[model samples]
Target: MFKNIISKQLYLLSYLIRWTLISIPVSVAIGSMVALFLWLLNWAIHFRFAHTWLLYLLPVAGVIIHLLYKLYGQSAERGNNLIIDEIHQPGAGVPKRMAPLILVTTVITHLFGGSAGREGTAVQIGGSIANLFGSWFKLNEADKKIILTAGVAAGFGAVFGTPLTGTIFALEVIAIGRIQYNALLPCLIAGLVGDVTVSAWGVHHTLYHIDVTDVSGQFYGKHLPVSFLLLAKVLIASALFGLTSMAFAKAVHQVKSIALKVIRINWLIPVCGGIIIILLTFLLGKPDYLGLGVDAGYPNAITIVSSFHQGGADFFSWLWKLIYTSVTLGTGFKGGEVTPLFYIGSTLGNTLAGILNAPVSLFAALGFIAVFAGATNTPLACTLMGIELFGGEYALFFAVACFTAYFFSGEGGIYAAQRVAAAKTDDNYLKKIFSKYRP
Candidate 1:
């Protein structure tokens, strides 16, 4: 029995060591590619802002992007969903061309003032790179899935500068209530290595701060720092955040369906979308809703950074961003929804703080991670992300907000390929909710 136990332990240790060795090069490649993508994204955003006239040619740019995909990007067009599906059902390997295809299209989308995010591009790059390496090594299907998971971890960690959260996210995101523990080691190694590699290239992520001093005061004779009232406000705002996530997901699906039905010419769909976005920009009298919405360094810019302060964002800022992003992506634009979701959640949280008379930065921070948790149905990952992005001073509040939002966000998510390994509620209740949204 002792020899058997030792043999099993040695086998496990050998397995871990082998995968760790493989993950090093995979993470390094993903990190380097993501760093380049981010650098180009920043340049594209700045160039668009400087020109300002590029917005007028959005439709033309849209047409060219449409042709690029229509001609040679059919497989790559599936984006992150393709990666998730491949992990779940390991079919033909992820394509090699996905990397350049998404990188160029996403940059073009941003260059022409399309409202989108960089996460999708980075993730596709990682998946493509991993798939290429897997094919080169002649990996089996099971090993291919594991490498793909590691690729996702590398991309997410490098892009957001959150290695632990990225590891958990790659594990948690495939199924609704289950995690792929088998990939944990490789994912962790890849996430950490990817983040470090990106930093080595002089790439930096955005910064966010929360003032915990006032909110940490004792209340009602309890030693706890967070107040009951603040917790209550978090609950209320988080529910709204969840509902908004559902709405965004539903809107994207509905818009795509409607656009496809209403338009006969496939290529003209994005052109029409570009025209609508341009008209909306003129109507709104500002371009704040365009691009990444992280920070434009311009006065009166409404962005994720702006949402942390009073009067930094308008009450309807979140709604407009939702509409803009949904339309931009639904009409066949290339980009991720995570950053735009951050914009929506933070801005909505900022609006709610004024109504609840709570701390603006505190609630914005809660909504930041909570909405993402709800949208992705990964509360644990989002909670860790909150602690990673902000400090752990408000971890309890982060947990409360993230878990609540996850419950309220419903069965649907931004990734339709994600399956329900376990239901959040009883069968009857979940069935009722699904029925309402089904048709």
Candidate 2:
């Protein structure tokens, strides 16, 4: 019995050490690559600001991007979906070329004034880098998937400086209503290490805030964190957030479908997309709805940071961003969707706060995570993001808003490859409950 116990402990110890070995190197490499990509992305955006004429060259840039993809990027074109597909079924193990290809294309998308997000780019970078390391280690089918998830966690954590949220998002985003515990250890370690590595590279993440005082004094009491009425408002508003997310997801898919049908010539889609974007920019008379929607350099820019203040964003800020991003990405522009979703959510939240008579910053923070939660179908991760980016003081509200948004978001999400383990929409449950009474 003593010998058996000793052997069991040894096996457990070996398991821990083995994963640590695989996960650390993968995380470090992914983190470094993400840092480099972020640096390049910043340079591209700043350079575009310096040269406004670059905006006019957007259609040409699209042509070049389409040609590049047609020539050597078909395999990597699926982007984040490709990574998820590989994880679900270990085929070739996420292509090593995906990292550089997406990195370059995403940079180009931003450099030429495309309105897109960075999360997808970071995630693709993470998955590809991690899978490559998995190959080097000669990991088995099971281990390869874990490493892939770890890569995603590392990329996400490093990109956003939210290790815990990254880990949970990587795990949760793979399947709706299902969290894979198989990658728990590897993902956790990779996320922490990845976040630390990016910080070591002197990359600074954007900061957000949420003050309790943003809400009315009537909602606060000595015993309760927030009044039930405020919670109700969040519930109602979160439903809209979920609907907005659904609309955005559907809009992207619809735009792509229509563009495909309307434009028989494959390469012309992006060129036309670029023209529409340019026209929109001229119509708006500013480039506010371009890039990541987090332009820190533009002091008066409408961004995630500005949405917390009253009148910081215009009434239609969310709608404009949705249109801009949908057109940009739908027509073959590279870049992720999460940051723009943040912009939309925060702005929408800002608008709703005014109407609801709630605290502007608090609702903005709620929108920040809630809409992402809805769009990604990862409420738990977005809730953690709220806690990480804003503050833990509103953790309860974050969970409430995110979970509500998730239920209302419908089955659609940003990642097409994500599996549907279960869906909890009220229509099905309500129909079931009232079916017996329908007679």
Candidate 3:
């Protein structure tokens, strides 16, 4: 009996080891290609001549956005939502054309100065690549799911250079209260490979820059008690950030709902949305809120946190981001809203930090993950992301804040097609609520 058990364990272990060796490099390669395209696209928008043609761009851009949506929106409807759908229904894979549609639309959005994120574009491209592999391998339903998960990890890891977080994101995103342990090895390998590949390819990924030279180990040793208080504040502030994120999501849904009701033609949705965005930019008298807003982080334009001081950049800039993102996404303009969520969280957290005299980097990191947790309903992924992007020094604080944000944000998710794969965190409440209002 003992020999039989040992033999079985050895077989399983060997199988996993072999699989990890093969999958990681392949997945990472796919992810790297996706990242290269995304980086090139973003660079073109930010540095190429496109940025110089602001005066005559709006109306022409509006026409292009209108035509793209009218012709391709329905088939492309399932980009983010489709990924969520596949998590609930295991055998599913995103359509082949979804990647091209998203890539084209996203490039158009950036070219025209639409406020959005790049992850969506990268993920779709990766998914499209993985989908081809799945077909070639003739993978079973379970294997297909593994491929999908690896693709997500690879894509995210390539962009963020945080393999652990990307791996966790792949496991956490599919289910509300469950993860597939069997899928971990492939996801981890893919994430690591993707990160290494992107780094090799000269992409400038996002990372937090903090100046901690002033604080010493003695300070940490003597002020160990202060860590708890800082964490406590982080927890409370993160919850507020989560709530605000929920509010932003609700606002988008409500606005989209109203727009659909008023404008029956599908093309008009993007047209009207583009017009609103253009009008807002003109009224604001600048283009600071446009695109990914990474330019906000360039040089010393005041971090989102410093905007909170009286007559500082915080209040209006944050509000403008909120309005611009809400309108741009809510109006059927095709793009990813995840990066905007980051901007929102960081700005809100920074504003709060300025008020409380807390460490702005600490609060900014917390807000970045907390809002992501609330928006995606993936607490573990959010926590991992904070550690990966900022560093593990505040891992405990990130975990606490992320879980709090996840709990307070409730059952709603950013992706409408995301089904409840498992029971909610609060089973009884979820059951009751689900019974009353079926998603």
Clashes of each: 0, 1, 2
Q: Between prediction 1 and prediction 3, which has the larger TM-score?
A: 1
lDDT of all predictions: 0.91, 0.90, 0.71
Candidate 2 per-residue C-alpha lDDT over 247-346 given as tens digits, one digit per residue, 9 for 90 to 100? 9999999999999999999999999999999999999987899898887546788888899998889999999999999999999999999999999999
**Per-residue alpha-carbon lDDT of candidate 1 for residues 289-315, written as tens digits (9 for 90 to 100):** 999999774787999998999998999
Model 2 poorest ten-residue lDDT run: 214-223
Candidate 3 residues lying further than 4 Å off, grouped into runs, are: 48-52, 55-59, 62-66, 69-74, 90-92, 213-223, 296-313, 421-439
Runs of candidate 1 exceeding 4 Å displacement: 216-222, 428-439
lDDT leaderboard ranking: 1, 2, 3
- Candidates ranked by TM-score, best first? 1, 2, 3
lDDT of 3 by residue, 1-439 (tens): 9999999999999978766765765676666676666676667566523454552364456567667655765545667666655645654467777767777777777777777777777676666666667777777777777877788778777766778887888778777777877889888888888878887777776556433412222354574423555666777897887787777778789878988999897667767777788888789766667777655424445433343223334555666787888877777665677777777877777777777767666676677789888888888988888877777766777888888888777787676765566755667886898898875
Winner on lDDT between 2 and 3 is 2
Task: For residue 423, give model 3's deviation from the true position in Å.
Answer: 5.3
- By TM-score, the better pick of 2 and 3 is 2
TM-score against native, each model: 0.96, 0.96, 0.86
